[model samples]
Target: MDKHGAKIVSVFSCKGGVGKTTTVLNLAGIYSLMEKKVLIIDMDLNSGGIAVSLGVDATKSIFNVVDDMSNNRFNTISNYIANYNENIDVLAAPKDPRDAFKIDSKYIDLIISTAIYKYDVILIDTTHILSPITLKVLDKSDSTLFMITNDPVDLKNARSMIAIFEDTEKKNYKVVFNQSKDTGKDYFTLFDIKTIIKHNIDYTIDRSFYIKDIDKYVIDKEILTLNKHIRLIKKGDVTRLTKIAIALLDKKKNNTRSEVA
Candidate 1:
């Protein structure tokens, strides 16, 4: 696809607990701020958290739309996607894990195509472990961000993922290193992890300013608005994240600028 055309990007890895949902939520926020029509779909049906992270309720989910689509009634998709801003929409995951398998490849394709027609960017957050649904997402994605953390197990999984997709259809994959601890100790830097994995690291997010004591948000089904104090302190973090989002969407500009200057 071209620069103006719609694109699907799935954020995945071979392991769990690597801040995948957090990356998706923050990136979606950045894209929304850029005024792009963005739709974030949570495919981690086992236990999705996009709604909880974004401070939204899960009364209606993407599963409802999938069921409607299977029965030839897709109008329900719009009904379930909770709108965060004028440009951002979110399709929450299934409340019941069993409902996830109910959605097959064809249904997922329909969901993806319909989403592309409606939004400029469709961001999918799949289960960390490789599964049939994850494969389907990978096959359909125009690009992907394989997430990893500083942990050795996560890095091992990252290597396995790069090896698995080495011959796959989606070769335009990149790496995102999250939850970096800058404790004045020269522990494994992003470069070290990149070297081990043998893939060019695209993003390295510093671990800081996580929302504390917010577990109740899940049960309350509330939207996770940044607390006013945090909004002020983390303004720089937000700007940095927005820059990453813009760079991802404008890939050629980087190469062209590098050549010219």
Candidate 2:
């Protein structure tokens, strides 16, 4: 019971290729399995791939919904929502990149407000660019998961972003280090990252957990379904992801309770 009616979590990164979308998909899947009503909004309008990654048809998208909104199409948000399963829904990005420009940033507030009433949790997968739309999405989020990697460039960009966040007093953020691989060689550790960014790394996801046959999974549209014959390592990865989802939900619940008090 979030005070805002729904808990919005925005997964963002200043750098790309850090597995942000993958993280959103897995977290949404885990929450869905827990019987939570989850909605994923692909805010990466220009090159969003949430629908394609999940192998779902995107006949209608946020572009259409926002276009309708601009034309006073109230209560039509549900029309563009695509069902991923019984527990999860998606508002995909436009099929054509050019259609993204038709959407105005002002409509984001309305879109999010509509989603809050329908979803228990809204997961926003945003583009790496810091456009006005992205800023609005971040401002509306209850929690922001900043995705990063072990790469130097990623860390540097994250540090710069963290500085901006601090300056703006945006404290509702958790840093997630993705695709982390340790070769036992002399490499930067979590402490080093914290020291560099002046913020603690909240979580680390192993690189091995990234599906090698991700393209095939997308084609099969079973990215969320766990295979019975999956290796033990993959199973462990799923368990870890479930824990992360639970933690996020618990945090939201606590925040809601505090707000009510």
Each model's lDDT comes to 0.70, 0.78
What's the C-alpha lDDT at position 83 in model 2?
89
Q: Pick the candidate with the highest lDDT.
A: 2
- Top model by TM-score, which number? 2
TM-score per model over all chains: 0.81, 0.89
Model 2 — TM-score against the truth? 0.89
Q: Model 1, poorest ten-residue lDDT window?
A: 252-261
lDDT by residue (1-261, candidate 1, tens digit) is 234556677788767766677667667766765677888999898799887676666778877887887777767457878876677788988888888778775677777766677787888998876777778787777667787777777788778778766644346666777663322433577778878788788866666535554466445433332234444666666666667777667646322111000
lDDT, residue 105, model 1: 56
lDDT of 2 at 66: 82
